[model samples]
Target: MVLDSLGKSLRGVLQKIARGSTVDEALLAEVVRDIQRALLQADVNVQLSLDLTKRVRTRATTEKPPAGASLRDFLIRIIYEEIRGILGKERPFDLKPKRILLAGLFGQGKTTTAGKLARYFQKKGVRVGLVAADVHRPAAVDQLEQLALKVGCEFYSNRAERRAEVIVQEALAHFPAHLAVIVDTAGRSGIDPDLIAELKRVRAVLQPDETLLVLDAAMGQTAGRSAQAFHEAVGLTGVILTKMDGSAKGGGALSAVSASGAPILFLGTGEHIDEFERFEPTRFVSRLLGMGDIQTLLERFDELSDKESAEKAAQNLMSGRFTLRDMRSQLASLGEMGPMSKLMSLFPGIGAAKVDQKTLDATQQRLRRFRSIMDSMTGEELDNPHVIKADRVHRIARGSGQKPQEVRGLLKHYESTKKAAHGLVSNRRLRRQLEKQFGNAEAPAD
Candidate 1:
């Protein structure tokens, strides 16, 4: 789900109608054409895609399937086998009390990813600490502090306007026992000597076990230049592509991995501290081929979804007690789980068509605005959006650092949620439908 449209054009043509030994040439040609289109649209290297297509085509015609195997099965099998071979094997990060330096463009979400990577390792029972080494004009230190809290990891920052290298030095001085340290650095608007020097300064002393180049998936080919610049300066061990939740063509993600000659280690899917997914070559290739990936869904749920909280949310909805406050809480939970699209895809048949591309993009924009407005509110106001009268809206808009219109939009979102909450309560069929769609194990049988 990182690049929602990456595999959108992929059409796996199932031409073999019945379970028959005989295969036709025209159908084979059509299926191969469809495969090529899908791979290209997925931002897969064109030559790689062409070569793969050739293999699949040649094998489809020349190699005969065993007696009982359907042509569909034969084709799927061949495609999977070839890709698995191409993807090769993966070597995960295995560092102990090791340092990992995160480098990327200013708005590429490097600081946030540093925190997420810490959380990922923390899950494995590793001690993790972060240094707010991003000493630039941006509020990078503050961002790291906030995300560090969300991950329950320690944060170190003098915020003394110290240079990036100095901050890393201080972090090393106070480095916790047996901990993984993530040193985040400020980024520039473009690839330049100054930016590279700042990162090189940090890289020179730390000599980290892994240096990840953070990039935005939406950056398109621009990501290529940034990756190349960083690699030339400090040599990236891997890459982390952020904002995978957006409608990025996935082209930039592909470009960074292929061109940078660095393995993709992690992906940032949302705004939350815990919103990340590790790279899995097999699953990714499967997705590129329009093959469903249920494993990713389950793994994400394990990391993000709290069963107890979900049960409580369900009971609240059934009892007609869900409010704007509940909506906010639920959204926070969803953010913790990676991309919104990925979460929606888990809802039975919703995966196939829950939200179209346009609506999904708009919803993400609206949600960001909504969250900003909510942040501006006091605890009481969040519980009672109705209390946000005109004057109060203006005050909150200023306090939250958002526009007055955004406050109103937040109210509208609350109104919509309130209506849906009550619907789940009064309508028995609606309750059943909701249960069937998102019910927890303990949900009442309405």
Candidate 2:
């Protein structure tokens, strides 16, 4: 709001000038000065911050305002574009795991990153193997060795010598049988002449498919210098900015990207290797510039459930044509919403924080019983559950392995959710976001 108010003030100033009133250069300079202060204070690089203000000043003076575009509108648009150009394209995490070479400062997370990337590929069904080439620093080998267990990948290490080249030769020979291989190399604080020379030797030996620089985003603007030094030393093909979730100065990673001219490939959001998110440039900039991540949510939903069936069921329910068959269809859809506790967590104010596991377990057991009881209905009986009187309930209980009381409870839960889904189908905007995330999941992506 404070920034928006400043934007409004500049808008008013430009509005006056576009209307043909004479404006002194002094006033225009003052406007650019205020804008510069706003951006720089937001943690933009001092030089880039200065260049942005200069571009706005030059354009405001040189170009005739487009018919009625307020000076503020013209200037804001220019600043937005220049900042984007500086931020550049989001580098994708596209390394297909033939072989990746990781290098970083000691304790800057290279081995852990290699393990995480390997495990990520493994989840995607790519066979993965790791070579812990970082032989210096006590148990850099053992540390990666222990961490490799949680990842379910093979880790190769040679403790006999600190020479990284010999490890690379062994890794290259072994990794070919696997779809992916991630190599971890030793790191030293500040550029160690010895370390870079050793990394270059390993790089020569393996000629890795990709070389990723692991940077700690926690270092703020200093990340830029660190990225530059690493790039000059061993050539950076891509960058992984770690620990952004804990940094408010997350924008500093942008500065590092701008400086090193390497695309950002992955973001380490949390401690676990699986906590990485593949960086998407457009969506990322959209979020940074205050647009929400609605598209990502849509993709996640589409990946989870069947779009066509969910839409049809929603349409049928809204037209007052709901049936017991529809309830069965919905059970399939609800299953797409993930485990019952996960479904509950999607409720506002619940996701991210942990929930009580005992309650979740009991609720899930009830769903299983509900599904079993529903299965006991005859085809025609399932289409219209009104036929399920006390006698039907007793028979279903006997057949489905649940008591009559449990059967009745499921009927009540079904009725409540049917009503809620009924109301939701009427709102087109809400329906779209819901459809993306809440339908049938395709047979788990092979």
Candidate 3:
């Protein structure tokens, strides 16, 4: 939910378009004004926002909708294109056997992003290695070593070496054959001559394939200046915006960095090492405007579970045979997809729903507790919840360290969820809509 306020404001404008009987000049003007206001409030550069809205307005009024497309849909497309243009083209980071040097100011999350990048490539079937070149930070080497162990990747650093260049050389020598090395460089409090000099030395020695500048999303309009400085010093291949999940100025940072002509390569979505993702401008803007990103959602599902398993789970839900075990598996899948708010944002219309994070967290916690309680149940009770009578519920409660009423609540939830799933499966219109939205890929047979 980066730039949450901006998303809300743009969604409101789209709602106005949806409500209007026709797309008229007045409506277009209103939409432009609203978008401009939203972008400015998100701390975007004023001139950039104005230019973008102008393009949107011109396209909406002059261009004709596609034969089957509605006027509202055409208008939305124009806005989407204009916003996507401002965000620049997507620059995908390919995980290969090459050295990647990370650079940025202090507290911009460069060290953490280095860890995340290593984990990302490791997940992509690469033998990844991390070289902690941040000799200035007291515990930076230790932090990268711990993250390497956590992700089961190779780690290289030299505490005795005072020069980062020497550390880089030593780390490269020790790296396993064909391993992709990510060098975590030190950052200064500000972009200073000393910092740039140190980075230049490291860069010359490492000869990295990619030099990425990590900028804090909360840096707002200043992100452009920082990116420009790094680009000048190290010839940056791309930029990585960090702390994107919590930054209100995320919009500004993204737009500003894009304006600097360095395509955003990735985003630090959360604190978890696995939360980083490759940046795709079109998909990102689509989700930002509440158009849904099915590809990303599907990728999440694929990461957490195999295709056959997911298809089987879907079949179970459709057939109304969802058991407590199935429910627990679903809960675990949801947990792996990060926060509910973020997952919901990837779904069209659902992002507009006013869901409180506290409520979402509480619901997730309840699901985990339910799973724990189910673990305490007998196998037959999980498969056939109706077999769990009052006495059995009491036993489960005692085993799970909860009251009997709580155990009963879990059973009630299962029943309700099953009923809802049956209702959805029975709705042909809903099925057709999903097929149309997500394409007609058939699920595995029940």
Candidate 4:
């Protein structure tokens, strides 16, 4: 859900395309105008936004759908490609032994992004070391130290020495055995002489393999100037855009940074340590267009859950034996994945369906209450939900601090879900229909 406002607007445009009867000039013109407006309102560069819409229009008019592909799908594909083209392609990271330096201006979430980067590398099974080289800022050392502890990575800082270069030089020697070292360097209000001089000295001492500028997505079009300034300062290898989830103007930063030739390496999607994700242009655009990103969804599941537990859940679901405990487990897994709206955005055609935020929030709250109610249930009741009578329901509600009617609602929901799951598993014709609907029955045409 990065750039929520822009995403909603774009999704609305795509929904119009989906609901249209034909792809005529009028429809095409309306679609292009809507897209251009969405991009411009998101603070995208004016010329870039106009050029993108022009390309989309040109391609839509000239291109033909592949065999068995609908004109709607072809148009959707064209928009996806043009928007993705501005974001730039992802470069595969060479994750060997190397040092990385983080640089940015003051108040851009540079320190927090350093922690997120540490966690990202830690998940990749790299032994990371975090250095607190931001000597000018008060408590910056303590902040990075706490982050290193939270991520369970090595930490080093010379609180006694104020020189950033001296601190990083000592940090390199401190982390000799570690494969990946990430240095959290200093920042200033702007690209001043002193800041550049300090970063240059630190760079000379560290000579990091990757020098990334931590930028705020809310900076909008100004992000390009900032990126160019930093890139010239110490030769930034890439950029890390932070606060993407909270910013409505992220599209401006994204397209502008790409124009500056500093590819975005990662995105800080949310405020949590686990919310960071590597930037993939096609997958990102696919999500934006409501095409779904099943790969990322599957990867998130794998990262958050146990492999054996996932396999067991799949088996139970397919065998029509899904239990209340299994449902609770799956719900918990979804909670860990992120907000209900964000999760919904990953499903094919769901984004354009315009799932209401109020409804998603209500559903999320109800799930939490259901989980709480389930926690008060006995193992016997979880395995066999039918055993719980009125008396037991009252007792369970009292135990969980929920109303009796709420308890009954949970049971009702459980029964309905279980029944539908059984239908999907046992009804062969229904399964075949679903297979076709989900595009699993045949190979898709290019």
Clash totals for all models, in order?
A: 0, 7, 0, 0
Clashing pairs in 3: none
Alpha carbon deviation, residue 440, candidate 4 (Å): 19
Instruction: Please provide, for model 3 over 385-436, each residue's C-alpha lDDT reduced to its tens digit, 9 standing for 90 to 100.
Output: 7799888989899999987888989989988988887654444344244335
lDDT score of residue 38 within candidate 4: 95
In terms of lDDT, model 1 sits at: 0.69
C-alpha lDDT values of all predictions: 0.69, 0.67, 0.81, 0.81
Which candidate comes out best when scored by lDDT? 4
**Candidate 1 TM-score, true structure as reference:** 0.59
Model 1, 230-308: lDDT tens digits are 7777788888888878745465455435556667777788988778987766666555644443345445555544566
Residue-level lDDT of model 2, residues 339-434, one tens digit each, is 877665443223333568998888777767888888888887777777888998899889998889988887787677677665544433543533
The window of 10 residues in a row where model 3 has the poorest summed lDDT is: 437-446
Worst window of 10 by summed lDDT in candidate 1? 437-446
Candidate 3 achieves a global lDDT of: 0.81
TM-score of each: 0.59, 0.56, 0.66, 0.66
**Cand. 3 TM to true fold:** 0.66
Query: Which stretches of model 4 miss by more than 4 angstroms?
Result: 293-446
Models sorted by lDDT, best on top: 4, 3, 1, 2
